[model samples]
Target: MAGVRQNTSIPIPAIIRYDETDKNIIGHEFSLLEKAPGKSIDQIYHTLSVEVRTKMVHQMTDYLIELHAHPWDGYVGGLTPTNGEVTPGPPIDENFGQLPDLEKYWAGSESLESLNPIPSQGFAGFVAFTVGCLDHYIYLCILLAWFHLLRPLPSPECKGRRHERP
Candidate 1:
C-alpha cells in the first residue's frame, strides 16, 4: 500500500531490529525480508510487448523447469498451515460442495443463488438433477475459460465480466 509522491523514486525495503519501533513514525508495521524482493509479476507481464512477452515467458519456462528439477523432500510428510505453509485439510464436508467454486471464491450470495434454478419435480427428478449438475459444470468451465482468455477476470467487484463473444 506504499505510494510515492513522485514517480522517479525506487522502493527499497528497510531492515528493522527487535529494539526498533518502526510504526512509531512510519505509521505501519515492518518486517525485514531476509532475501525476498517483492514485485507484482502480473503488473510486470501487463507492461510487456507481445514479442517481448513470448521471449520472457520462454525464459520463465526455463526458470520453472529449474525449479521443478530441484530436489523435493520426495515424500509427503503432510506439513501444515501451523508452520505458515499451506496443506490440504481433511476430506471436505457435504456442505463444502454447496460452497463457491474457485471461479466464484469472492462471489456474492445473490450471484451464486442465481445459479440455482428450481430443479424439475417429478418421476424424472433424478435425471433432471443429474443433467442440471452436468450442464452447470460445463457452463462453469466455459465461463471460466472465457474469463481467463479475454479479460483479467471478475473479482467480487466485477462479477459482471460476463461479456459474451461471438
Candidate 2:
C-alpha cells in the first residue's frame, strides 16, 4: 500500500500505524489507516450517468497506467517494509491462510521460502521461479488425486473402515 502511494496518484488511505506481528495488543497483525474520502463505489455506480461512468473509467485507466509505468525491480513477490523501505518477500497466496491443513498438501521437503525465494537473477529468474512453483503445485494436486483414487473402498457393513470416501 505504501509503495502504491509512493509510486502512483491512486487515492490510498494513509496508514496511520501497522503491525506485521501477532504480538501486538490485537493478538493478530493489523493496519490502521485513515478512511479514504469517498462513498462506496457500489452505492453510487448505478446512479452515475453514462458520461460520468465513462469519465470514471478513464480516470481509473490513467491510474493503472501510472502504476504500470512504475514497476517494481522485477521481483515477483509481495512487498514487505524493511527499515522503512519496501523490500521483496515471498509470493503471497490467498490459500496460504484460508486453506485448512495446507502443509499436508505441500509436495516436497523444501519450505515455501526455499521454493520461492526472491530471485537474484531479476525478471527472468522470477519467471522461472513462478513456473517451478506452478509445476510443484500441479504435481501435488495430481499426487493427491491419485492417492484418493488408489485408496481401498470402504465396506458398507464395516463402519470402522478408515479409507471411506468422504
Candidate 3:
C-alpha cells in the first residue's frame, strides 16, 4: 500500500499503524488506516447519471494507467514487507488455506521459497514451471478418472454379487 501510494496518483487511505506479527494485543496481524472520504462506488453508482458514470470510468482508467506506468522489479510474485521494505515475495495461493486437506497434494506447501520458482531463472524457467504444474494436475485427473472407471459396482439383482468392468 505504501509503495503504491508513493508511486501512483491513486487515492488511498494513509496507514496509521500496522502490525505484521502475532505478538500484538489482538494476537493477529492487523493494520489501522485513516478513513477514506466519499461514498463507495457500489453505493452510489446506480444513482449516478450516465455522464457522471462515464467521467468516473475515465478517472478510474487514468488511475490504472498511472499504476501500470509505475516501475516494478521483474518478478512474478506479490509484494511483501521485508525488513521495512516492500519486496517481491512468493505468490500466495488462497486455496491452500481454504482447503487444508488439499495441502498434502501440493509438495512444499509449508515453505514459500520452495513454492516459488527463483526469479533469476527468467521467463523460460517460469514457463517450464507452469508446464510442469499443468502436467502434474493433468496426470492426477487421469488417475482419478481411471480409479472411478475401474471400481467395482454392486449388482442390482444379487445382494452379495459385484459387477466388474468387462
Scored by lDDT, the top model is 2
TM-score of each: 0.26, 0.60, 0.55
lDDT of each: 0.41, 0.64, 0.60
Name every residue pair that clashes in candidate 1.
Answer: none
Task: Please write out the lDDT profile of model 1 over residues 1-166, one tens digit for every residue.
Answer: 0111111133334333211222345543334533447556786877779998899779778755754454333321111132533442221212212333412443553343334322322123345545656665675566557455755544787576775655
Error of 1 at 70 (Å): 1.5
Model 3 superposed RMSD (Cα): 9.3
Model 1 residue 158 lDDT score: 59
lDDT of 3: 0.60
Predicted model with the maximum TM-score: 2
Per model, how many backbone clashes are there?
A: 0, 0, 0
Least well predicted 10-residue stretch by lDDT in candidate 3: 93-102
Best-to-worst TM-score order? 2, 3, 1
Candidate 2 residues 26-131, lDDT tens each? Answer: 7655789998787989999999999999999999999888876776765555666779887765554444321122344454553444433334233345567678
| Model 2 lDDT-worst window of ten | 93-102
